[model samples]
Target: MASPRPFSRYEFLIAWRYLRARRAEGGVSVMTWISLIGITLGVMALIATLAVRAGFRADFVDTILGANPHSTVSYAPSQVYNELTEETYFSPGTIQDYDALAARIAAIPGVTRADPAVRGKVMATQNGQRGLGDVYGVSAEAMAALPGVVDPERASGDIADYDRGIAIGIGLARTLGVGVGDRIQLVSPDGAQTAVGTTPRIESYEVVYIFSAGRWDIDEARIYMPLAAAQSFFNREGVADEIEVFVRDPERVDDWTPQLLSAAGERGQVWTWRDAAGSFLAALDMEDDVMFVILAILVLIASMNITSGLIMLVKNKGRDIGILRTMGLTEGAVLRVFFLCGAFTGVIGTAAGVVLGVALSLNVDHVMAALNALTGGNAWQPEVRGIYALHGELRAWDIFRAVALSLGLAFVVTIFPARRAARMNPVEALRYE
Candidate 1:
């Protein structure tokens, strides 16, 4: 008679029967279940972690770009920081023609908005409360164009008379117990010199608006006053401390740098957002790599359980393997049959994990809200998290990575056990039986 083809119908039929273990094979069945559960949990956790990491990074970068300038121009060297006020003190006429320089830069092709500003740190006082405030002196038009602030959704007051009043952060407003229409005092230490000494310049402006910049640090420390008012406050009349430049695409900072310099001419040098935040962005990338490595190890550990289970199955089925070999089954067919059993378990487990992980990512926010409500505590504060809502971004790459990791591990570990069963000595295996 002709030898049976590889993995013939009878071989599959026999493999299926063997997988449905009898009372004598109860221990093998338990091992199979444990292996399947382990793979499923590992894949699920890996995918979920990736989704959360991706979401967090995207949200953080978006907030940074939205609430802050993409680039800054000042009458100082590129190495000089944007917050440096000493540049203005040393070279009073370096950026004296700020209005014209700003207009020129604003007309650049990729430029969106170029707003002259004066930034300073001062003491804020209201209702007997005191806190340090980061004050920005910007024009009414620039203040209106400021992204994330003066928004109808987040702002509590109007900017109709912005020059006559100030726009403060909601966090700062809360801290100082001030609200729209209330007066808050800003005390600057850099006042005009007198015969005896310099006195603190104390000025109070009505709160025209209260805005949230979506960042706890910014919302807790920023204040926006009119350009002319800010100039006078900083003793910088007819000149701006610096000009903030927003672009159409922030990633094109390098491309726009030359054009910005040309527009700035001899007036000022360009300082990019990256100069201010590159280190922080690099740190985030490092964090992502670390998280991925840690979670991948979890998958590796979980997949090891498959090795134990398959070894047990091979040992318990030694007698059956001997009978099959004597009955004309090829060694290759025996290996294929056992391989299918393990492969089936891994594929099914991985599919179920993908489903569970995706579902969890999609409903993470709702889950967080439900848990917060059930616990009746206020631990998840936007001010603490720097974002108003939690988000999870599921990606195709994440799912593929999880599936490939699980399936690859399953196939590799299945090899030795399947080969062992195939190479069994029929006489020796049957002698024990």
Candidate 2:
């Protein structure tokens, strides 16, 4: 053990004075400032990138799970041999006993709700404007229980009136230039059969409610109507196209697939949310990995600045180091002092970055809004991004990674210069001075 240990008061005091030197003192203060700023900005950029990526993922997932079913069980097409045609033909899938099937699914453990729904495409028109709409036929109870449909913040008009009228998405409302209590005409080509041919089923229903599902595609094309109304309109009075299943944990949907498949038997097949959005999610994951690697390289480049700063400091202080060594200062003490100088910059820069990164991530939407207001233009287009605003989320693990990266690089780069200072020959260092 030594009398004065490493990182002692005097070591730190000497490091502090060296760090605070002016331009006239051959201080290398300029390089110090530049390196410190580089580290700070690098860390901030890394944290902010992680937060934004996480936000995009969360936003994408929330919309998927909130607005769409975790899994869909639809009747599977079966091959039937027809004697009249003397050939086998595939019959279109339709759930004849939907009520029983939905009940069976709802009884399964971890299952939340099973809704039998009729789905179809129709042209919606109002005020001489027409847009294609995807209509979902669900019972009033199911509609009321839906997270996206019943969200108080995004939903308007009385839900109780939904039994008599129909509900529409905000995007559809915008397209038709209508609001709550307005009437919209739904025209479907697959309609009632007459002697001559099938006629289009055209019905006008008041838009009793409007909801935003936090997704542009869903909001623009989704419509909901009472089960009875949809059944009568679509000529599917006794059956549903499929059953939408909800569970306690959507992330664990694969775990429940076996149960769903077994319950469905040969009558139906299961389709999970993962199957619906797997490609997009995979792309996002690849993007996140690539972005992280690129930013890590940036951090390393920024950290190299620390090496530049320290080398300059060492060269300028060679004479001082030699004098200190002659005055009973050990080489270890010299090393510790320079190490402290570099370490201080890293610690302070990293701390500042953490604060700035967290602030930027937590308030990304607000910051974007301010920028949009200042520029008199919208930056986050909901139609393009599938979300209303930029979602930014800061995870503890991300912050830790950023801090570790900055400090680790700083420490590694400082070692090279610190060793050079420690190994300088006193005679050689002071010969020129």
Highest TM-score: give the candidate number. 2
Score every model by TM-score: 0.88, 0.94
Model 1 per-residue lDDT tens digits across residues 105-177: 9999989999888988999998899989999888888888766786789889887878789999988999999
Give candidates' CA RMSD values in order: 4.3, 1.9
Candidate 2, residue 153: lDDT: 90
Summarize candidate 2's per-residue lDDT along 119-147 as a digit string, tens digits. 89999999999999999999998898778
List of clashing residue pairs for candidate 2: none
Whole-model lDDT per candidate: 0.82, 0.89
User: In model 2, what is the error at residue 34, expressed in angstroms?
Assistant: 0.6
Worst 10 residues of 1 by lDDT: 85-94
